[model samples]
Target: MAPSVLIVGAGPAGLILAIILRQNGIAVRIIDKEPTYRPGSRGSGIQPRTLELYDILGVLPAIREVGEFVPPMARYEPGKIEPTSTARLGEWVDPTPDVPYSNALSLSQDEHEEILRTHLQTLSCSVELGSELRKFEHFSDRVVAHIFKTDSDGNEVEETTTFGWLVGTDGAHSVVRKQLGLSFLGETRTEQQIALGDIIVEEGVKLNLWHMWSVPPKLIALRSGGATSKKFMFAYTGRPEHIADKTITRDEFIQDFYAITGRHDVKFGPTSWLSNYRPNLRMVDKMRDGRVLIAGDAAHCHSPTGGQGLNSSVQDAANLGWKLALVQKGLAAPALLDSYGEERLRVIAQMLQLTTDLFHKTFASLHSADKSDDSGWKRGGDLAMLGVNYCGSSIIQEEPDAVAGSAYMEAEGGRVQAGYRAPDAPGLIHSGTPTTLFTIFNTASHTVLLFGGDLEAVGKFPQGAVRVVEVLPQGHSVGALAGSALVAEDREGHAYTGYKLQSDGFTVVMVRPDGVVGAVAHDTEGVERYFQKIFI
Candidate 1:
């Protein structure tokens, strides 16, 4: 099939959006201007909410196999390397039935992209490296783009293609975003610049703990690179005077490391990558412009302090993918695409506030009179991103009780609501085998869980666009239902408890393709009403 979607930039956002659209059988062509897959440990933290999304995308297992938990930081006082305190950046929590992946996973951004790329390839789509989106024109019906492709022999060729949609996942200085004329409004924190790099530590450093040192106005930190033994990722707040007029080099990194830690004994090897990172609290005024849209760094940029940059970008793609697929398939009106920006803009606005506030708090605490204050280093709660929802989104239905303004509010006491994350329930018996809700949920279509065993409700939705499941109580026989819907027995009552449903009560939950509860209805009429908004 010819590609229907043209994605600019093969980073996580673009890769994930391609993966999702392809999962729905949407053909996509993803391109990046870079000569090869980029390498770096940029934005290494994967929040719990992202893990849940990856679970549906079938990439979580590989991520978990290679992903390492955030290591404890070995805090060292000046001139004293061996004697100091150690602490984890975030508290580790045991997994629950509703929340299977509770802790943040740490793997370099490059490794993360490789996993996503591999998954995309499995779906029969590959990213076009050295293919740059030079220009694009968006019409009411389609997007026409001109791309520059450099072949192996260094020959440059230009091609024009028409696509149903165009998405810019290109980084901060996005050519697609500039063409759309979207306002990227925010300021750069020049005072909070940090030098980041990946290097080989020859000796005298352990891989278990992230080494840290405080130099009052500057902070230096290093952690082991999970993919390789001798490699490590490090960051240092460089002194303005030292970095004023010189280019960043391996020698400069070595000098900064030695100056900050006073550890002349620690030997260093080759530097793989180095960059001067200045935090920018900026986001586009909107995420879409007709047939052209933007996601990830192309749409927003913020501090790396809370590790929310990449996670937010990935979520942006998740939120937009299914919507675009529906529109492309002609299953929904074009206005369905409007909710993509309406829903995400509100969430991104709050995320910017949270991350920006966290950034200020972390740096303020670090440079305070009490150098031993670790309060700012603590992370959990909202930082885990489990609370992110589209409660007030125009697409959500029958959620009168859901708060309209904030997207960060968690469903109180595990109470399920429209727009909240669809909770996962384990110990479900499907065809005499134990299975979980996460495994049953489909990423390509909406999942309608019929707790009342209303087999007739299955007829209300389009066949391929929705999957209907009948949830029976423990010991209930599935023989009574004669329908196409899959039957799962809640053998351990986890499904009822997690969703706040009584054993005999009938409840219908519509889990969106993104794994968010789209509607909590009392009957088939409400379910039909909800799908009316989603489908034409």
Candidate 2:
């Protein structure tokens, strides 16, 4: 049987979107043009917000076991083995009840994709490798896709299939986007180029630190711990055309590395992967075109300076998965899918600007006379992505006369407002069992958190669409609650503190499947009003 959804590209974005859709019982098929899984340490930084999403998807445990915190950076002079400055990449923040994973994690991109593919297997779905999307025709109700692949007998095969929808998670050179004719408007930074790859380093080189060298003609940086402890991810600026064009031999590449770093004592084994990276600050004009949609690198591509590319791409898939599931299941109107583009375009725009600014700051500091300027290295604040929101999205709702502030920026004075990330609250008692907000939230349904509300008076919304959880203050009786709603007593007051519930009145916080606070209503009627915009 043909799948209901066809996802082109089996990268992190495509794999994650398939997982979310499959979890919601949607039929999906993911394909990649490559014959085998790609290898490299591309976009290796995982932010805190991404960790929260992974927890919801049940992949956090494996990621936590294999991933390590971002290592501190060690700067060195041209030929000096020691006697240099060392500092952390970003200030470390201790975890709190609201933000359990506050620090960024370092794991290779290939390993990351492998973990995601492994998780997808448990769901009875897997990427169809060696299959490529040749062309696709989009109609109002369905899409016809032409696929090209080699059969088991080594003969080439061409097949035609149909799907309810098509999504492109293919990288920057997206055939789907080009076929859709969406304007990819942005500039290419010809001046900024670097050679990135994964290589096995010789013994005697420390594997716990990220080493940086400001050699005369080029800047070389090596990040330790790739697919193995012996491997390192290396990046060198001042790209030569020969290297970019892949005309440089392996010996010449090694010679250039030794020349730039002046470290002949450290030797490197055969490289596993190599590519020339030129920053492209570009974004598509729209994310959707009728029955077809584009996401990740297809919709937007930016510099890798702040490590926002992969994280943003993962979140984009998360945001679209639930919405598309609803539409495919007939649980909501087709217009609900439109919100995917609406919500993500804003966040992607802000991210492109943020990353571009960081890119310029980093290169400026490196070229300037002041070698001690570490301000560009500092990452936190908005870079953590905990502050990214969708308050301006048309689907989000708040009380009348409420000011709908900007999206992706921290609220004034740390206030949790509508359309912000639903903060996690620990130390809750659920009918004599310990629970937390994150444990209750899943990728399948909306989690309606009622704080200090009368269970009987709360009007009925769509039961199939939401899970009602009534939260009471500490010391309150969490005894058998009325109706199907689960009762949770805030044993440590973290629920109220994390959400900033200063008022003692009943408050309803509707958390979307993607973990964004869709609405903060004062009454049950307001909650239904918000649902009206989503459900048919």
Best candidate (score: lDDT): 1
Q: Give the TM-score of each candidate.
A: 0.97, 0.96
Residue-level lDDT tens digits of model 1 in 221-329: 8877763567888877746855633446888788877877888888999988988888899998888888899999999998787888899999999999999999999
Q: Candidate 2: which stretches are off by over 4 Å?
A: 226-228, 240-249, 399-406, 455-459, 502-504
Residue-pair clashes per prediction, in order, are 0, 0
lDDT (C-alpha) at residue 308 in model 2: 92
CA RMSD per model (angstroms): 1.5, 1.9
lDDT of each: 0.86, 0.85
lDDT of 2 by residue, 1-536 (tens): 55899999999899999999999989899999898999887888999999999998999899988899988888887788882888887999999998999999999889999999999999999999989998999999899999999877877899899999999999899999999989999999876677788888886468888888875337788898743588788887875655554433456667887887678988888888877777899998788988899889998999898889999999999999999988988888888888888888888888999999998887776776767778777787678899888866789885465565445576555555677889899999987889888888988888888887554534455556678888888888865556646888999999999998953778888899999888888776788788888888
Candidate 2 positional error at 176, Å: 0.9
Assess the local accuracy of residue 498 in candidate 2 as a C-alpha lDDT between 0 and 100: 91
Error of 2 at 248 (Å): 4.9
